[model samples]
Target: VKRFVHISVTNPDIDSPFAYFKGKAIMEQTLIGSGLSYAIIRPTLIFGKEDILINNIAWILKRFPVYAVFGDGEYRVQPVYAGDLAKLAVELSKTSENIICDAVGPETYTFRRLVTLIKNRVGSSAKIVNTNPKMAFLISKILNLLVRDVVVTREEIYGLMADTIVSNEKPRCSTSFSNWLEKNADLLGTNYVSELNRHFKKINEDAGYRISG
Candidate 1:
């Protein structure tokens, strides 16, 4: 039998305030009830070649003159490289038994440190500054209007302020976000693309906006 492999987020429980997280928990339940041997891989803040979060941060830094940090910015995050997670997914799919594990990178970085790493690695000229969550939201909204793109979403601001992206257990992957950023510096922020445009808006060859990853 071909092993069933599922990818999920780290925390997907009913108690989660976020609707997406709760829905993921329900999705996991459905998968488990399928009675098929499966492996579930949960990753915390995945980072890799042209990833949404990491690359978007670079995109903002590239275009903007300022970057805002919510509060003290001590929140932690463990990022798994997409390549490492894909490799692990293949390995887990090869196994027959039901399994669930967190896929995280070996290193942990605080929010401020994460921003700093991206800025330094990408050679951003944007001035990084600490601001209250409220002010950050206002600034982002203004930026969104000016840029004609969703500079930052309200949910993203909440997620960042909540600082719920880190994993407590040991990481299963060896890829480092800092190293990967250094290596891919040339292509990280070549353009600022929206998620909707990437997944949609280009169903046909000439329908609308062309999507890229």
Candidate 2:
């Protein structure tokens, strides 16, 4: 039996920060209609080694403290670790059935707190501020118009309000954020330029691969 497992988030609505989430919801809907044994896992804000979003944001905020929050910094989030989510996905893959699971961290933290952790990591005494959704929307709209990219918007802030706290359901595995941080402490604030260079070097060693630039 082939089981299709999906890792999704709480907000798949159009008013999401990332347009990709709505696409994910569409995929999930299509899968359900396709009569296949599948499992959908909606994980919360995931933070771990090599995490693009959480880690990058933390790095930026820690280094540059001029970032503003969407609201009053009261929104709660359950930041899961990537490794834990992978373990659960693997376990689910072993079975062939349609199941919807919400993967989340053990603790609920506010958006401000999340940034604070990053601030501490980067050793940048950056301060976090709060802003209204409308103001954010205006700023983002103007910026998008000028820069040809919508970096931040109101709908995105609304989406953030839809926290990913796992309801009263048993998580297949539980990896606390602190534990994840501890285990991946070495990768907390490293530049990783060497890692990228190593990847290119390996690629160059492959047959018929050439760097034309």
Candidate with top lDDT is: 1
> Which ranges in model 2 have alpha carbons more than 4 Å from their true place?
11-21, 134-154, 164-168, 182-186, 189-213
lDDT of 2 at 67: 65
Highest TM-score scorer? 1
Q: Where is the poorest 10-residue window by lDDT in model 1? A: 204-213
Q: Which pairs of residues collide in candidate 2?
A: none
Q: Candidate 1 lDDT, tens digit per residue, 26-143?
A: 8889989888888988888888775877887887888778889877888788889999999999999888889998899988888888988888878889998889888888887886
C-alpha lDDT of residue 168 in model 1: 77
- What is the model-wide C-alpha lDDT for candidate 1? 0.80
Residue-by-residue lDDT tens digits, candidate 2, 130-154: 8777886676576445434445445
Cα error, residue 159 of model 1, in Å, equals 2.6
lDDT of each: 0.80, 0.66
lDDT of 2: 0.66
TM-score of each: 0.88, 0.71
RMSD of each: 2.7, 6.0
User: Which pairs in model 1 have colliding backbones?
Assistant: none
